[model samples]
Structure formats: C-alpha cells, structure tokens
Target: MKCSAPLALASATRGRPREFDPDQALAAALQVFWRRGYESASMAELTEAMGITKPSLYACFGNKEALFKKALDLYERDKLKYIGTALEAKTAHEVAERLLNCALATHCGASDPQGCLGVISMVGCTAEAESIRADVVARRASSEAAVVRRFEQAKADGDLPESVCPTKLASCLMTVLQGLSVKAQGGAKREDLQGAIDTFLTMWPRR
Candidate 1:
C-alpha cells in the first residue's frame, strides 16, 4: 500500500493535518537508507532529507525496518528490474549488452549517484544489518537465477550453441556486470564498459 508524500507531511507538525506524497517520501527514504544503511540512518536524517517531521515519518512508514523493506521494494521494483526485463531480448548477446549497459547507467549513472544498494548494504554494520543483508543476498540470487533461466531459453531457441552451458555463461555475465558495477561506482567510463560488452559479445558460442 502506498502512503502520502513527505512533502505533505513536511508542512504540518505532529498532531496536525498534513498531506503527503507517499511515493516521493518513500523515494527520499530509500535514498537515505541507501546512503546510510538502516541502522545508521536516523529519523532526523530521514525527516531532514525528506523535509518531514519525525511523527510524519513514523506515520508514513512504520519503523526503520519497515522503511528499509519499503526502500528495498522500491529498489527491486525500479533498479533491479532493469536486468531481468532486458534479459527478455531476442538474442543472448543483446541480453549481455542490456545487462552491462544497465549496470553502467544504474550503478554509475548521473543525478545523486550512489553505488549499488546491495553492495552498500552488504559493506557495513555487521550485527544489526543481518535482515537487510539477507534480503539483498536473496534478491541477488533470485536475479542470477532469472538471468540463467533467460540464457537457458536463449540456448533452447538456438540463439546460441547447444554446447554452451547457460548457467555458466549467465554466471559469467552476472559476474561481469557486478565487476562493471564496482568499476562504475569508482568512475569507470561508459565507453570502457561498452568495450567490455563488445568483447563479451564476440566470445559468444556459435557452433
């Protein structure tokens, strides 16, 4: 269920009436959690970044874990879907390109550029970070499985040779994408990544 935006909650104080745009608020919350992690992300930072009050923050989203889940949902819905959707392409090569360029734009794209939420979340806060970290891990596994399934389909369709192992190739593609994402977060150029993409394309099994 969607809630009101932080904008609406920002205007009015606690106990008073205020309209909020849930999506906008959730998006802002997502950024905060993405940058700071759930434990490190405080209500002040969230409300401040969101331009809303603590009560409004609590009201809109139940608590920190809930907010984190909401943020993850948004990431899954918005960011992670890029690769899965792109893998639906007619050719396996397109699938690879789509995965790489998507990683390029997503992990390193412009405007409030933050590294991957998955990697960022996995990096710090060991004890308090278990649930979110687990979620990200599961999400990644699911994503890899999806890509592998696509590669298997591509082989079945004769888009690639029968001799190739789709799971292995998909694993390679996913690893390449993860590496590209790490490089991208560190300022890897689009063309450089594209060059890598081109290299992968040439190596496709064709017999």
Candidate 2:
C-alpha cells in the first residue's frame, strides 16, 4: 500500500502533528479514483476517503494531479503487473492468453472495484485535463507496442503465419482487452468475459 511519493515520509518527519499511514491513505485514494474519474474526484472527497485533512494530503501527496499520478502508478504496479510477465510467455499465443485471462480475473474479481481504473480514469477527462488523458493514452500505447513486438518475434520464430501483420494483430488484441474492461465495468460476469477470451484466442495467428 505504500506509495512512491517521497513527500509522505518527509512530511511525517517534519512534525505534522498527526499520525497517518501513507500506504493506507494512498490505498483509499486509489479506490476513490477508481470509483470516480480523475476530474470528478474532488479534493474534498479525496481527503474524506483518505481520512486526512487537506493540509495533510498536500504534505503527503502533493496536488491533485500529482496524487492521481501516484495513484495511477500504484494501480499499474499492483493491478497490471501481469502484462510484463505475460510478455515472457513461451509463445505469442500464450502471451495473449495469459494477458487476456489475467485481465478478466483482475477486472471481474470480487475484492476490487469493477472495470479498469486505467481505462476509465481518462475516458472523459475535462478539456483542462487533456495532459492527464494523454498520459494514460501514452501508457496504453506502450503496452500495445509491447504486444506488437512480441508478435513480431513470434512471426520471426515461425510461430505465426507469414501472412499475419503483427501490428494489426496486436491492435485487435488490445481492442478486445479494452472492450472487455468496459464490459466488465458495465457488469459483465467473469464467466462471460472468460468465454469471450476463449473465443478470441481461437483466432490467434497460427503457423
């Protein structure tokens, strides 16, 4: 639960006159952001959720933008760790399987909030928060790029057909991935997403 924000530790040492768990506070903030998008998550709601005063939040996490960034980092590290691991899978098809399955579990799990914080966080960002939207989009692009590179490697290794375009294949998978997140957010069940993933995997490129 500990955040990467150094200010939390620094502020604690400066005699803030209140003892709060930065990790716990950050976890609370993560939930708030997951439930409400970046622009809609007001400081009042954040402070209330984190169980801290405005001053304490500022001292520990910086401004709202900075706080959201930290929260996003935590979200990726905790919730999306599988993406990196899946890239190391034995084959490109296995990589896609691992990714889609993991995504289904993560998004539809009972303990966490529904859907993807990454997908929903920037969906309707205000004009004033265009940079935030761009940031999320860039991260997503990086992820899609990784998949594309993996597919290219697969093509070279003869795991996929020469007719397959790695870039287009990666985009198709990513499109399904994002769509699954949206559907999960809208109350699609785990069984339904799993069924969809199974069907999609059958379309994975073959030699």
What TM-score, over all chains together, does every model reach? 0.81, 0.90
Q: 47-143, model 1: which lDDT tens digit per residue?
A: 8888788877776787777777888889888987887689788888888878777776776566544567776676655788688788888888888
Give one digit per residue, the lDDT tens place, for model 2 in 40-137: 78999999999999988886677888889889888999989999999999898999999999998887775643778878876758678788888899
Candidate 2 clashes between residue pairs 3 or more apart in a chain or in different chains: none
RMSD of each: 4.1, 2.9
Q: After best superposition, candidate 2 residue 166: deviation in angstroms?
A: 0.8
TM-score of 2: 0.90
> How does each model score on lDDT?
0.76, 0.85
lDDT of 1: 0.76
Q: Tell me the spans in candidate 1 whose CA falls farther than 4 Å from its real position.
A: 1-16, 36-40
